[model samples]
Target chain A: MFQNDAFRALDRQESLRLLAKVPVGRVVYTRQALPAVLPINFSLDTDASVLLRTSPDSDLVRAIDGVVVAFEADEFDAATRSGWSVVVTGRATVVTDPDEHERLSQADPTSWMPLRDPVFVRIESEMVTGRGLRGTRGTQ
Target chain B: MFQNDAFRALDRQESLRLLAKVPVGRVVYTRQALPAVLPINFSLDTDASVLLRTSPDSDLVRAIDGVVVAFEADEFDAATRSGWSVVVTGRATVVTDPDEHERLSQADPTSWMPLRDPVFVRIESEMVTGRGLRGTRGTQ
Candidate 1:
């Protein structure tokens, strides 16, 4: 979480529910030896783990192996200038289990544009935290 | 610029403006042969250049050379369901010119947390584009 006083503590339940509802999120990974963030289509299974469908030859699939990755989804209310966001940090591993992979990619795994069958990468979150800006000043 | 109906044309002016107005943006880079995104403090200079000052020895600095980096900032107005975003795609190079470097670093590049020397990385943009989602229905 941000050290600034402006960042408010977000409600875990509400934020998690919102995150689960959304079909897409930004997957932060390391690309070409630098930090990169890309939009990913994923599903939050009953076990609270995330499933990402990506091509086996894709850079994202190759980069994330037993690495600590961050996945985030956020919504900000501009009129009120207040919003809540949730971030999940965990270890990312390629899901070799066929049955689990099928269930995760049952539908559109990505929200932006269409794609072919993507290799499934699962990020098992170790830490889940959220922050928000609330009150009058937050709406500014 | 987006191919969709909402956002058709984008230019440098709009991109620089949006880049300046937004408080948060993702700095894309390559790390461990993957793309990763990190949010950091940035200031816009009058010459349409974005300024970033980071610690000289950090992994972020070491990993930014010869890579196609993308820096993006956007704000969504929930009331109108509309907002504008600007993204700059270019290669990032470490600024070695002392006199020019001093001018940018002078713009108050201190961070909330401890970071020393403030090495500057200039993202020479190859393309500046923006997209506006106004009077829209689906997610931006």
Candidate 2:
């Protein structure tokens, strides 16, 4: 086999589910010649897409057109000794349709990030992956 | 002030320091209508700058041309009951000069990620921010 199980991963729905439960995640993309990572609040849509807002003349907008990118959302509670992370890899496109635009416009950013720009972009999942770790307390 | 103190918080150096420790982080930039996030493996330069590798044709190279962006890295240890996060916001430009490029080219990505590409981008922190949380051991 030409694949190592370490690199081989999961599908969209499973990754999306893990994403939905978490309130935060980092959006990864390339900036300049190096990889850039930024923290953001995101939402999981019915179509298995992740939505977030940005500015019109922003660098993020400049680099991310017609590209297969990765998106992730996750959460952890150290007290309970449990946590889960979900990553979504897909093609990101800036949505233009009005009804779709209105839907994002009407959504809340406070649930995600305090500072949200005027424009919104949605990433439709081509593939999604996730992993979870849970600890159980038991009597020895 | 009208702000959620919990979300609007950081320590400055922590974001930069955390980036050095955690190889994986999210990159945020604009992609048309929405803010995009992708996962990346990065290292912190001795001066506290963040660095990563990429291809010349990569989306990052195109988007981060002297633009303001954020490079964030973080970590959470449930077993240790502690966590911290770091972020850098600044302009990203390509390493057009040769000498600077060679220094970054030698960074070890194996412990980080399998990054292929010669181009390097530095998200110099115009403003560095950070935050941390630690769980307490109590009667559970």
Per-candidate TM equals 0.59, 0.54
DockQ of 1: 0.15
Residue-wise C-alpha lDDT for candidate 1, range A19-41, written one tens digit per residue = 78665567776666545565555
The CAPRI-style docking tier of model 1 reads incorrect
**Could you report the DockQ of all the candidates, in the order they appear?**
0.15, 0.09
Local distance difference test, each candidate:
0.64, 0.60
Task: Compute the lDDT of residue B33 as modeled in candidate 2.
Answer: 35
True contacts kept of each: 0.12, 0.11
Kindly list the per-residue Cα lDDT of model 2 for residues A27-59, writing each as its tens digit: 677767544565555777778788766555557
How many Å off is the CA of B122 in candidate 2?
Answer: 0.9
Error of 2 at B127 (Å): 0.9
Q: Mark the regions of model 2 whose C-alpha exceeds 4 Å error after superposition.
A: A1-11, A17-71, A74-140, B1-10, B77-82, B107-117, B134-140
For B1-140, candidate 1 gives per-residue lDDT tens digits of 12145444557777787777765566766567544565555666665656666667767778875566877676655455456667777777777899988777666444433344667777766777787655454331
